[model samples]
Target: MSTAIFRFYEELNDFIAPERRRCEFTCVLARAATAKHMIEALGVPHTEVELVLVNGESVGFERVLDDGDRVAVYPKFESLDVSPLLRVREHPLRVTRFVADAHLGGLARLLRMAGFDTLYDNHFADDEIERLAGVERRIVLTRDRELLKRRTITHGCYVRALKPPQQLREVVDRLDLAGSAQPFTRCLTCNAPLRAIAKADVVERLPPAVREQHTRFSTCDVCRRVYWEGSHWLRMRALLETLGC
Candidate 1:
């Protein structure tokens, strides 16, 4: 057995025991335990960890824990430059696509409104979500810590906020998504990229007021839904502006 001192920083404390939070605590470990094993053993999903240090030296999750070792685990560094440190994942996902769990439908739509490729289906099961995320190389956005803990999920985030708008803000800040956001470019209902359509092409489907007043429009390639810069669009745009995207 090995005894190691562990300290988790920032929001990571949310996953640990109240007595162990924001302070060093001793953990008894099996001989040759890896940092990954120890971290998951404490209930913090490995996907949420951006960097880990053992004895003040940067190390990967597979690094072996030693007796009296001091382990400091940190969540994703939104503003900090830790390129010199050892990160668990080899590289970040470039496209930033996401698959939200069944419960985060509101957030999924909001993400779509922000022009992110967000996949959301109210019927998506945990297994389906996991499989889709892996195949599509999508970042899992979910509130279920247990789901995020799965080994197959190499990239994911546990959303901390409760309300949809707050959750969107949290994700935007945590993932540094504001800069990448391209608002109103995706179909909110189906998650498809919208292509500009000639007003004449969709004019028959538009409401009388929309047909007379609106000359610009876009449509979902997947669901064939028409989109226009109407009152709803203005309202949604205002909301996204408040989020600074």
Candidate 2:
């Protein structure tokens, strides 16, 4: 058996046992266990971990443990650059496309409203989500810890907030999405790009008030739904602005 001192930083502690949270604790490891094995054994998903440090030295998850090792596990760094030390993965997801599980439909719609390409279906199975992550390179966003622990899921986020609005902010803040966000540019219901449609083409379909009050309009090609600058759009714009998108 190997014994080591372990400390989890930031949101990583959410997955660990309550007693071990925000505190350094001793742990026993099996023979020849690597950091990846040890961490997952402790209940923290490997995908949630961004960096691991042993004895003040940055190490990858594959680093084998020693009897006297000291391990510090941290979630993704928000501001401080640890690019030189990142071993779990070298770079962040360049394209932040996401595939949310069954329960996160509200968050998925918010993401779509913020111009993110999001796929959501109440019937999406865990296996399908895992496959999409590997085949399409889409980030898996869900509150399920076990789902994020899958070996095939290399990119993912464990959403913490329960409310849709809070969840949206948490995801945006954690992923640094403000600069990349293209609010109101995508169809929230159909998850397709919104194109500027000629008002004449959709004029007959518009309600009397919409036709009288609004000249700016867009439509979803997939759903053939007309959009206008209305109260709902203003509310969404406000929400995105608060998110710094």
Candidate 3:
């Protein structure tokens, strides 16, 4: 049987079984396998890997594994420039859209508030979230480590923070989305882009004071929700600024 040694770094160790945690582990196989396959065999999903080094040489996911090969795997590095060590894919996407699991409704709302296309539905099952992520090419944001470990998920991230606001910043920083911030341009209630609407068109829907006090307006194309710069807008802007968006 052919065998290889693999050592996962950082949070990746969370996926390995208790017996193999935090150290090099041996995998016995009948024949050569791709680095991606070997990684998934070790319980970490291929999506979680940003780079792989085999025998001190950078190798792509499709690289064939050889007997006695020592593989080093790294999880996504939020602050590191890994372009030089990229194995299979080119540099990771600078801005990544997200699909949050049902439990992250608040985070989804925060992402939406930040003008991101965040897909969220409380009734969606974990499997459904994974499928939608694959189909829509969205990154999976989930608190469930087991769900992130699935082999089918090609792009997934395990959010480290529990608070919704912190989770939003975590996602943005992790995905290098600081430069892509476009605040107040999306519908927070639905993942729809907001369009400028004339004040007179939506006047009847607004409160008397809102109509009298504000002239600039934007409306959600999908939900038809009207929006105006009000007291809450300043609070949201402050939060966004604090998050480095």
TM-scores for all predictions = 0.97, 0.96, 0.85
lDDT of 1 at 147: 95
Taking the tens digit of each residue's C-alpha lDDT, what string does model 3 give over 1-245?
A: 78999889988888888888778889885466889877887788777788899999988888999899999999887677777665555444455788999889999988888888899999989889888876777889898877876756767888888999889888887777777888888899988999999998998899999988999999998899998889988788899999788
Worst 10 residues of 2 by lDDT: 83-92
User: Where is model 1 more than 4 Å wrong at Cα?
Assistant: none
Q: Model 1, residue 87: displacement in angstroms?
A: 1.0
Model 3 error, position 185 (Å): 0.8
For candidate 3, the TM-score is: 0.85
Model 1 vs. true fold: TM: 0.97
lDDT of 2 by residue, 174-231 (tens): 9888899998899989899999988899999999989999998999999999888899
Identify the leading candidate in terms of lDDT: 1
